[model samples]
Target chain A: MKKTMTRFIPFFIMASFLVTGCNQNIKSTTTAAKPSVSTEAKKDQGPVYKGKVVGKSNKAKQISIEVGKDKDAKTVMVSFDDKTKGLEYAAAGEGAIIAYEMRDGVPFATVIKPKLATLPPGVTVITPTEVKTLIDSNKDFLLVDSRPGNRYSASHLPGAVSIPVCEMQELLQNLPKEKDKLLIFYCGGPT
Target chain B: MSTKSAGQAVKAGYKNIRVMLAGEPAWVKAGYPTYANYGWVCRGNIVLIDLRSAEKDAAARIPRSVSMPFADFADNYDEIPIKAPVVLYSDKDEETTAAMKILHDNGYKKVSLVEGNFLGWKRVGGSLEKGPVVTDVRWKRILAEGEVSVAEFERALADPKVATILDVRTKAEVASGKFPSSQHIPLDELCKDMDQFVCKIRDLQKDEKIYIHCTTGARAEMAYKELKKRDFNAFYLVAEVDCKGNDCSIEE
Candidate 1:
């Protein structure tokens, strides 16, 4: 009975980890009531902005976000303070969902959290075990390491071809010409 | 990078694209074999091991390779550093794979096999040695380019006049605490607002020394690159740092 319980311990811990991870993702991606709008969040409040952070001025205590859902999105500058949550995530190239209040026509961020970028449709995530099984079974698939060339040269998956993302444009020829062939890509891991 | 690449692949009209989310590290942790190209075997900073027999190794072996016969690898593998990037090859692919498994199973993080093995090396005209085999592994991790030694950073911290300490961590990170007499500019902010930051530091001479640091040195390196573009004599700390209300410690 003790041995059996010990074997189950790892599963229980993994289950808890998965639960926490899912909850965290849900909270960050869905906290804002409104999506892609600078409308007033509540009574006497300014507005909530959801978009990718474009530029920042730490000295000015302001971050610029390309707000809205369209390509012609306007950049809005939002100020933050010590009280602001997720200030670390307020950087260029990172997605942010900011809840702010306007004071004298200036937006002051009350809460700032990272907006997780969901994976696009058609591209699916494969586990390492699944990939290993494919290799073991002699599957006809192209496993490409999409990290830097140096990293690829240092070490990479067995039978994996090197087509670094940085050099993807120039090295497109290295990729299989047949469009229908399965192409599995991997990097340093989910960052 | 994989996701971005996969997206690009989709755009390029490739169908059935799948991303290995866990990637090489996870694959390695699962005791799977990895392969390195011949160029890496020749030039990479790795402990290349010839896993063939002592007789075969003495007869002919890859240059700069140490002989660790697969028969004796189980007992003597620990002699190689745990952190060393290990590359192995032998006449028999099975022996090479088995040796790699032993290293991975025993907590070696970076282990790979030479692509195509011994005959492959010969075909590529790889340098070779004969007569005797090197038994001992001689390796030491080197600091990356533009990196400051921890001791030097500590000295600069003690004496602010030695070098201007630049803290490139984010505002949230700084809210906890930071070192004394250090200039603050988050990496992203510095990169985005280069003109503004340059104007602020306009008074300093171009040759003035600066030591930059972040939580884990990744951001510091980025900041260092930006500073270098502006021709500032800058070096980044490549080590972990912990701070509490102006008191801090660094580790490599």
Candidate 2:
């Protein structure tokens, strides 16, 4: 009886080895057949820009993307094909990033994503030089002073007029009629 | 009012409504022209609340504006008149919104948030005043309450009745580590997701008390106030809780 049991044990061990080897081969073959699943997962995890479509010039299907909080970021105009879907458009606001691809000189916006935009670190405030250039270049712009009338009386920009943001709508008539004119506005800090 | 984010100057039957990014601060920093005060030239009684640092006040400020620092805002409240048209001015909209909330809560009838905050004021070459004005007295009433200590909060967490723990910190902050069993609802997006949070709270049972915490006590306090205003029983954890074998630092 002992001899018979020993022979059966060896047979059982060989059968188990064959089954395990067969399972391993099957698993390796299945893995080798499909490789795109892992690659597709990696592709989905790509960089995404969150911005808004600030401006759309008629002549050029160019849309401006302003990134970051406070709209402190400069406007970046990217041209999109006229065939682009209007459904792809997004509203302009804080934390909006319009993602587009630049091919040659034209840009094609593929997606518009909104994020909790943040100001870029180390960006200096708008300088006097910039203001001068804006005023000189944009003659038809409206210049609004957000300060109170008393403060406006003390001093103000040459062509600027006081229209406190609180009462801006009421004083709309005081604003320039031309759309192309650059509007320059200012306010006083803590004092 | 149209539903639009701040600084969105869209042309809604108007030509070239440009919203300045930094408003007045950018204008002042640019060394542009400014006036003295809301002049006698304008009609209607307008009250200005100035939110600037003590140092900035020495340079220039809006005349007739009551000085109110953004940090120590709650310290001055009584200065705000309840019946006047209140206009809040700050370097940024963050402070303006804070001030507007305070004023609105105190029974101020007409409150308008300056579009660009204070920076918008200067962009149009407005006005300025140079002097230290008396701060508002209403801030004292805005003192935060219901802050639980860290140890006390941990003890409270042990109670199974505390069904939901909310972390109001930004996503970036939560990526580091968060208290066990706490879900994230950033402060900025809290209003947007308030319905989802309420639904979750209801699923857990309306009687279940919700605990909230942020990097620091400030955001948690804000969350607690906002939730309570919406009739939710919310508590703010004032101190940091232990997470991942390390103490969570409360951002100030």
Candidate 3:
């Protein structure tokens, strides 16, 4: 028994060395390739926006705002806050300047300075038609139906997925990780 | 297998994205084909629960339905009489489906999910109840302990004994509100950040208390459960309030 154990000891050591060496090689390969994966993730960042209203709608409480139009020409629909309900209003074809910030391609008008067209850094003005056209051209973008599934199922933009904004975070993990993907969101107007 | 919009694709972290300005209206105007409503059966006695917030309840709902938002569903589950046919519908089926599963696992034997959800009901010309059907006693007992008004919560904040206030809203919501001096830890990310909570309470006695809140209280309740599971003694402060903003008004 002792002789047999001695004979197998060298084989065991050799096998262990081989397994450890292969694992090290795999680890090194993964380590060397990790930076590219992260960089790719970073490259997927969407268009960011800044700036404000460049147009308006005739309908009460409806206004057309332009932000970051020079670089991306993003346009958004805006309405007055409760405190500013009776302030001077613009008719259709009228434009107003506003300040805004957007991240991961989602835009929100943060500050509104009416009557003064102060273009912030990295901002541009674009027509609604241009915004629509830009959206149509992007094939890899993600179109989200912010309405309920019933509305989504009844009728939705071509290739859009139903994910009501109310449930955005619950479904976030299921969303793709690529940054270049455009996420377009819409509701029944403001609701 | 449904169509995707450019904006949705982008928000989903996809590289390419877009938005149809007209949204569903545009889809209809473009002459895109629509689908027929599918039928869904209630799992049991068919108590259809609308999980939309009170604000949305006024817009529309399924016939013979009760209203409860996803946030309030768990606490309110006991309010739903057990052993009845329980069906859940929401603006989005995904959320309702999730809520239904929660009910099912919690031992509600006769639960069924409404097919096509509320939208389908509307498409079929189903009648809608304006305003929420007031929650019955069963619901009140099972789901809500009532809300702590904002003013009351503010008063609590002033109390020296209220050592901590945890906000379980999503990071996005936290960033949007940036509520003064509150620690923001999304409910989903709570487990990962447990140490932060632990560290905050490390010096406190075992019976020491902490306060928690969310946009309403649903998430706060869920977070409260998780905290208890982790052996932390915490209490949830229900706001019992509706959203206040430029958006259209919705009556509960």
Per-residue CA lDDT of model 1 for A1-191, tens digit only, reads 35543543453333221111010121212323212211222332446787766555554566777676556666666777889776866766555678898776667888776553233346555667879999999999999887788888989987888887777676577778999999998777311
Q: Write the per-residue lDDT of candidate 2 for residues B149-198, one digit (tens) a residue.
A: 55546665566454477877766667768765566777655644567776
Q: Which ten residues in a row have the lowest lDDT in candidate 3 chain B?
A: B243-252
lDDT of 3 by residue, A70-155 (tens): 56754454444444332232222223333334434333334433221211111112222433565568645555556666555433
For candidate 2 chain B, which ten residues in a row score worst on lDDT? B1-10
Best candidate according to DockQ: 1
Q: Score candidate 3 by lDDT.
A: 0.46
lDDT tens per residue, model 2, A65-139: 544455464444455565544323343322333445756644566654332211112111233345557777865
- In model 3, how many backbone clashes occur? 58
Pairing residues by index, what is the TM-score of model 1? 0.60
Runs of candidate 2 exceeding 4 Å displacement:
A1-97, A100-143, A146-169, A172-191, B1-164, B168-246
Ranking by lDDT: 1, 2, 3
lDDT of 2 at B35: 32
| Residue B201, candidate 1: alpha-carbon lDDT | 57
How well does candidate 2 reproduce the true complex, by DockQ?
0.07
How high is the lDDT of residue A40 in model 3?
Answer: 27
CA shift of A157, model 3, Å: 43
Q: Residues B1-252, candidate 1, lDDT per residue (tens digit)?
A: 676677678778887877665567767776788888888898888999999988889999998889999889899999898878999999899999889888988888888998789988898888888988789899766678899999889999989778888898878888888997788887656766777875655356678789999887766766776677678899999888888889887877
**Selected candidate, larger DockQ, 1 vs 3:** 1
